[model samples]
Target: MNKVFKYTSIALLGVTLAGCSTVPLTGRKQLSLVSDSQIEQQAAASYKEFLGSSKTKVITGTSNAALVKKVGNNIAAAVNRYLSSQGLANQYNFNWEFNLIQSDEVNAWCMPGGKVAVYSGILPITLNETGLATVMGHEIAHAIAKHSAEQMSNQMLLQTGGQIVGAVTADQSMAVRSGVNLLYGVGGQIGMLKYSRSNESEADRLGLIFMAMAGYNPGEAVKFWERMSNGKASGTPEFLSTHPSDARRISDIQKLIPEAQKYYKK
Candidate 1:
């Protein structure tokens, strides 16, 4: 009886190990070490902490602010529809919120579980509603793609044994927190917050599709990217500095235009 139990446990472990897989849309194979529920709990907690630390300015009745929210919400809805059609709707189970920050840094990001912030500083670069949609779509796409979770999970796999990827008991979560600080580029943290070039390209392509599906003209992406490239050459935009170089990003986006155009609503 003891021998039978040992062999059965070994077989179960083998099956679980073999089942690690990749996500759709990005096609980057994942270690699948962490369960979705576990990650969601962690992400939700982290997101709340982030919000608490942030000094938020609620945008009220302003044209620019309203436009951004309108476009952002539209993109979010489109992303939900896309996920639902793919039979993956249950993955995002949080209340999504979008807000504009009255700041002078051309920056934006979506936290895990769909907390999005767009800075007023980026408005000039966006130029119009379509351009704003392009930026918001791209940022929101990162959340939809589960890039943050993948990034965190990859760090865990690297630190812990990949064979026991999903086995981070509560005792090990403290060590994982140290890695998170480094991953997020907190000053004095050991690791660099370097995003791979492939991830950047994927975001650009997927972002383009999301914007188009949300009723913005896909061709606007090309022009918007061109303006972005020019802005970088003239002087680096704060947002573009950490991103892939303008030439590389623009070329990649141009290549993705036809596919994005297919999803264009008008």
Candidate 2:
């Protein structure tokens, strides 16, 4: 390799080490090459646009809609309480919002900044409040763990050839914005990287703990995933497609329930 490129690679490796942040509860180090506040702002705009767009039908004033908000808030409160207890609350500046959207796509997601949406189609699979809590908690875990930003940072690092110290400080790129939109199935619908399997596992573990802290039985998550596994549909639900529900995932969640139970109380 040329001297310039070789030195640049070494510099990038140093930055990579210095730029790592730990995922709470999981203690896994992840890249932190981007700004959380910037990503949250972009996500907020995309979420607002998604809500305001003509094709979107946001359900309101119904029992199900209320339930969605309730579960989201409960999980958010649990997460916040846990973070605050750890003196890590200041690290997470989440302005939580939850809405039930009218779609038969069987999907739900939580964007960075605690913006959450639940598709009406998933309700049948969720069945009840605990089930909804399972879903919301899992999605919220993604935000809490900063999975989206981590993915974006890794992408930026790749695209900029490890010059992210400068790139991340610049205005958010269209690529980043597209990623935020894609998380919600909003714009372009391309090039967004899915969370890694380890990230998925972290979400499952933290989700169960969050749900348990919110007074839901973590064991319910197993049954919820079972229903998701058994459901018949015309095609793969967006939830399962992104989430990868399989025997191993279900078994891993089962193994995590005991850990989650420590936070549980009647």
Candidate 3:
């Protein structure tokens, strides 16, 4: 058993090293054992199902909705342009879609293939177009950075038995597979919130640049996060939480502003 464990550990380390990839902008190395197509296919289907079943109405033809779409598209475009210039265009093949869902969740997220949803509850906190851009940019940065896939890959590594079961059950019924995927995806989102401080910080930094490239002021990110921090509900302490403290996050953003400003058009 000891010998077997040693071999398994070595094998896993080899696999991890073989699958490592650098995150754009941040230059951080990350595990990416799963293919982008695989993750995106799952995300697309899951996102569709979520919209279909949830107490959700897609907001359109309204000023707020238009702003959301505009900001999302701008950020997506800027990221695409940057990727293309870096010769990493093939790394991103997103069927980008942005929507505003009528919910009071104080949250927004972007799935693997650029499926973005913004909750109505967050709008009050966002306050204006730049604030909206800050949130959207950060969320979009998560997708572009492939944070979800990285998390899933990490889970597969840490949960070898569960990964084996998942592979074996891949041929199960659509209903069963969808159910599992949906549950896992939701759990992954929560897990993302609870174990992604470095990912969040990287997103914040990249988000500042993306928003600036999209023509929004990067400085607004500091103000937006301050509002979020001030309005935060009672929860875990910042040190123990998955996110950096608001003050720390704001200070980091301030430091990145000079670099991000170079991308600002206006």
Q: Rank the candidates by lDDT, best first.
A: 3, 2, 1
What TM-score does candidate 3 reach?
0.82
Task: Give a tens-digit lDDT track for model 3, residues 13-81.
Answer: 877888899999888899888999999999999999888875678888999999899999999998999
Those runs of model 1 whose alpha carbons end farther than 4 Å from true positions after fitting are 1-21, 35-54, 161-195, 231-242
Model 1 scores a C-alpha lDDT of 0.70
lDDT of 3: 0.84
- With a 3 Å backbone cut-off (N, CA, C), the pairs that clash in candidate 1 are 33-166
Q: Using TM-score as the measure, what is the rank order of every candidate, best first?
A: 3, 2, 1
What do the candidate models score in CA lDDT, each in turn?
0.70, 0.83, 0.84
lDDT of 2 by residue, 1-266 (tens): 23334555576687688788999998889999888999999999999999999999999999999999988988899899999999999999999999999999988999999999999999999999999999999999999999998887766655554353234324657775445333324211222324466678889999999999999999989999988888544365434354445676889999999999999975
lDDT of 1 by residue, 1-266 (tens): 23333544465456547646556576666445566667667766876675566565556689987887798889989888888998888876746777777888888888767788888888888899999888888888777766766666556544433223233322446667455334333431222134434556677888999998889987788787787667645365423344667887887888888998888887
TM-scores of the models, in the given order? 0.73, 0.81, 0.82
